[model samples]
Target: MQGQHIPTDAQKDEAALWHVKRAGGSMSVAQEGEFDAWINADPGNRLAYDQMRVLWAQVEEPARRMSTAMAGEKPRFDKVRQWFSPGRAFAGVAGAVAVGACVFFFNPDMVENIRADIVTENETVTDVTLTDGSIVHLAANSAIATDFADGRRDVELLRGQAFFEVTHRNGDRFRVHAGPAMIEVVGTRFNVDYLSRNTEIAVEEGAVRVSSNDNPQGVLLGAGDRVAVSTAASLGDVEKTDPTAIHGWMQGRLSVRNVTVGDLVARLDNFASGRLVALGDVSERTISGSFPTTDVVGSLETVAAAVGAKVIRTSPWLTVIY
Candidate 1:
């Protein structure tokens, strides 16, 4: 022990918090290995991380109870109650595994003050019904903030795609904010894809007014119309679209035609809990088929097989296709 370097108490606490935060988002291949080495460096690191896990669970217990109560269902936190039991801290051999593994924080925790009423985790979809008898279908890996007050209904696509079925209310309109686009709906259904910096709108029923930071004057879209407007590129050509092709994902099947593999992979990520990276030259290759959202990785493999590419699954949380 003469040459051993021990981390201070403060350093242990810092390392614990840092690991928790790093686990919040997708970790790269390098990050995963670095995380393992950092924790294994000192016994204090494992102890501090275990304590942080228990504390983090305690913070979430109340919210779980509240959500259960609001759903008119019984509490479903047996494991949470165990975490709170005196002398039942996540410890010992189990504690070491818990400290090293990513369990407590997967996606970023939705801190207090996030206005979203419903949030779907990776590969999960949440459907919300408003007081006005309208419905919003939130896709997987998506978050939306809803505001229905005064005389109007507004839903913001904070990230990912959402399908809105709006019902006209006392002559007031329903609006969706996707990046720079302001979509006003008049008793219609439509899908909005807001990922990265690009926004695409596909109208299925009625008409909508689409405006963006670049073209605020707005464009009118009727049923069966689709357009893509992004900050990085000029607005896409507004054209007639097939309703089935645009809205098929709602039924668990994604239909794509003449689309690049890059785009197909991006769409697949919406329903995949793990991260899928399409590398290099394969991105530009075209792909067409009806990919099932139920079997996300299988669909990727199916697509890869056709193009003489390969699917490399590094872990449950990371997959690479090339």
Candidate 2:
């Protein structure tokens, strides 16, 4: 065999795109390590990927428009050709073409710009161990991106929820971020939910402080304390909650108390791959129970009975209660 030279930057770009093509779905923990190693092999790989992420974010809106326009008319991709100009400015022909391929081929449902250590799909509850020996139990449809560097441990909750059990160290802060808010602690067990159209933090042990962009003053939360921060606005006062009852989803149980029908449906639909649509006048009904997350449809039936509504299943993909 002849001797081979080091790969040029363009060659690394091609290889990085190859990895990106196969990414974004569920993979085993070991596979995630291999993938991370490949991405970290060269600075060129990361630089190329940064360009792709920018292109991906730019394509999202255009993709949405194209999908809406194609719903009634014959399928057409020609109109999108002119839109490639934005991507051209960020990358070369190869990179621009990669963006086009993803825009037309991959899942539009996955809008998360995934550059992370590990990812879990909808309806899954999996656990991950970070470099510093901390454990995170990830909830359904959630994504976590972690960076443990120097004297700090930083993590981002891209979407959905996660319960972090941190291991303490002197002079270092373990921080979990959701939206614009940060939950900092020396060591503790806590859950963060980003799926409720806001950020919710509930602590089961130790204590943590939460601060947001708009409300930088934030609040201190002790064990059994919970709080909510509306996106970028103010955070509500801390409230007390039962940790075992609230975090029972780890045991396949969905527990709640005095929540409205709409709120219940939203929680159920998180575990369901299908749509759970509620008809009129069902939003105000208060619900309290322990329903199994493994059987969301069954739980929906229980909700229907409690709220005096009928369960209607048109297909496995759609369920309606009214």
Candidate 3:
């Protein structure tokens, strides 16, 4: 009988890097090709990557419990001895945040600004009127590059989200490119958010045509219509939305329904300095709430309370919820 092939330590490390790189969602064309080549290089390489993925998935629950205990929260059992004060506990967790923040806080915006025509910092929103008279309400931590040429208007969302009140001009088309999706309108008010790996589109007035890389035929969305396109370029079902609520972020508000703690943290992270990380199973729990984006610490506490979790603000730049 032949012995089973085992992936070498180098292969394991390379596989881990590949997983992180892909999760970062900033892979270049050349990097993607290199990734494909590496995956096809050997069967052992695939096995190692698969192992890494499984290991990552399995750690979530344990991470939650450990983080909760580390924050000086009351454990499930009274018998368990408490080892640290709340301040010291948060300091320990903050130390971990400091390490992870290096990756999470990696200045992607700096790179984004290289090609961005307009950029907004955290906690700030900007309004820009394009040469064609189209108005864009760019959200915080967002960047956009505009091109008004060839008798057409085009805007690419480099990062974050934006609301467009497009101006009509002799049937010339206005297009907004976000992730795998393209939104085209003649004259309309609409919102596009590409903060996550996916792109979400919502129309406020008039109509717009939305298409994705996979769905080139596209779909026409009227006012109050909302949809999302996944990272794989797959279109989601169109849903009805309230036009007034479509751009709530503009008012420093975020409305969520049955949203996971992890996802909520990610959105709130955009409005404040530093980062908010949900550790352990608490991150997976779901809750519904309307949070004030301007009051990130208060909002985090409210979210944690709703989910029966605890919030630990180790510093201005780091908050851990578990």
Candidate 4:
């Protein structure tokens, strides 16, 4: 560590603010002068700024490729441009591409809108009554497709979360598919969340037979039971939970007992206009709160405070948490 410069928290925050302002658009004459002076003031300052810019580009690389691929264009970067200088056209293009990603890639509801039988936007919930009189409470930014045929009542949750109040039928089996996990129930009220790496199920009434790729035989979950199945279809712990809290989003509140900061942020991202990128491994920190689904930014700030972290708005389309 002798010849290296480590940026302090203050330095990092200043660099992040400067990057956001510069990426916002062209800077005013005086603002540009101030930025140049601040960045040139110390070797560590320049290092911090460059690090911020590089982090932005790295996180955006996937989104850029996704956008260009959809447009039938190749993904390329300006190799000669300095990462710290936000005035580069490359930065502007990347930001614009990120905006497109927010609309198309990150927002799965939009990508799957055509194929989904039911979809909900952010900060909104919708109730749909199926052919068999079963009711579904679709959460914000969620999508689902249904098929009822041959004595089979199937619902595929393409993305996000949903609560089902299934009605009983004499010879029909009601089943829900989320990622690699499958849940079957005759008549029950349950919640299923299709997360980034797992599909979670919480039973509020009656019982459900849950199976995943790892556990093909499946496990039976009754009232007040909750379980998470990994993307690989492996089962997680079957724990006790409050039935009311299981589908709390339907009431416009998110209640958690001991959720990790990362998981909380992931839920908040569904409501955010852009993205919430956690800078470090903040998973060890956990928080318990009942956040308002309508005020996502406020809930995010509360979560950050509980985890002893900072929230930096790096751009209109990106927020970095540390």
TM-scores of all predicted structures: 0.64, 0.64, 0.68, 0.71
Q: Output the better candidate (2/3) by TM-score.
A: 3
Off by over 4 Å in 4: 1-111
Worst 10 residues of 3 by lDDT: 72-81
Candidate number of the best TM-score: 4
lDDT of 3 at 74: 13
Clashing pairs in 1: none
lDDT of 4 by residue, 1-322 (tens): 4138777555665776577668655468998999999998987888878877776676555564554333311122333123324533223333322443343334434446677898776667889999999999988778899988776799999888889999999957899999899999999999998845568899999999999877888999999999989877799889999988999988888887777776777777676656655544454477898998788778888888888876666554566555
Candidate 3 has an lDDT of 0.73
Can you list the residue pairs that collide in candidate 4? 213-233, 214-233
User: What would the per-residue lDDT of candidate 1 be over residues 12-53, giving only the tens digit for each residue?
Assistant: 445543443354454677977877887787776666566656
Pairs in steric clash, model 3: 64-280
lDDT by candidate, in order shown: 0.66, 0.67, 0.73, 0.73
**Candidate 2 segments exceeding 4 Å error:** 1-109
With candidate 1 superimposed using the best TM-score fit, by how many Å does residue 52's alpha carbon deviate from the native?
Answer: 29
In order, what is each prediction's RMSD in angstroms? Answer: 11.2, 18.5, 15.0, 8.3
